[model samples]
Target: MTTEPSQLKFILSSVLLITCGQFHYTFLFRAI
Candidate 1:
């Protein structure tokens, strides 16, 4: 099965979103 460019973009965006969310939570915890 060949991976399409759109699929790769989706995966990368999802990973970035998760990373951002984790960082956001960490920052909130530190602030509190």
Candidate 2:
């Protein structure tokens, strides 16, 4: 499989967003 730099960046950003969302959700659940 061939991947470009932009594609790698997009993947990394999406993964970061998902991880941040999970952390935020966990914090909210604990605070509630």
Candidate 3:
């Protein structure tokens, strides 16, 4: 049970990081 929640959290964080990275890249490209 606890392990499942931990796994889910890890997956969520990875997804958030990827999305934020993509967003930042686009913003930087636009600024250039």
TM-score ranking, high to low? 1, 2, 3
What tens digits encode model 1's per-residue C-alpha lDDT throughout 1-32?
A: 89999999999999999999999999999999
Candidate 2 — which pairs collide?
none
Expressed as tens digits, the lDDT of each residue in 1-32 for candidate 3 is 35688899999999999999999999999999
Tens-place lDDT digits, model 2, residues 1-32: 99999999999999999999999999999999
What are the RMSD figures for all models against the true structure? 0.9, 0.8, 2.5
The prediction achieving the highest TM-score against the true structure is 1
Answer with 2 or 3, whichever has the higher lDDT. 2
Assess every candidate by TM-score.
Answer: 0.91, 0.89, 0.88
Clashes of 2: 0
Of candidates 3 and 1, the better by TM-score: 1
List the global CA lDDT of all models. 0.99, 1.00, 0.95
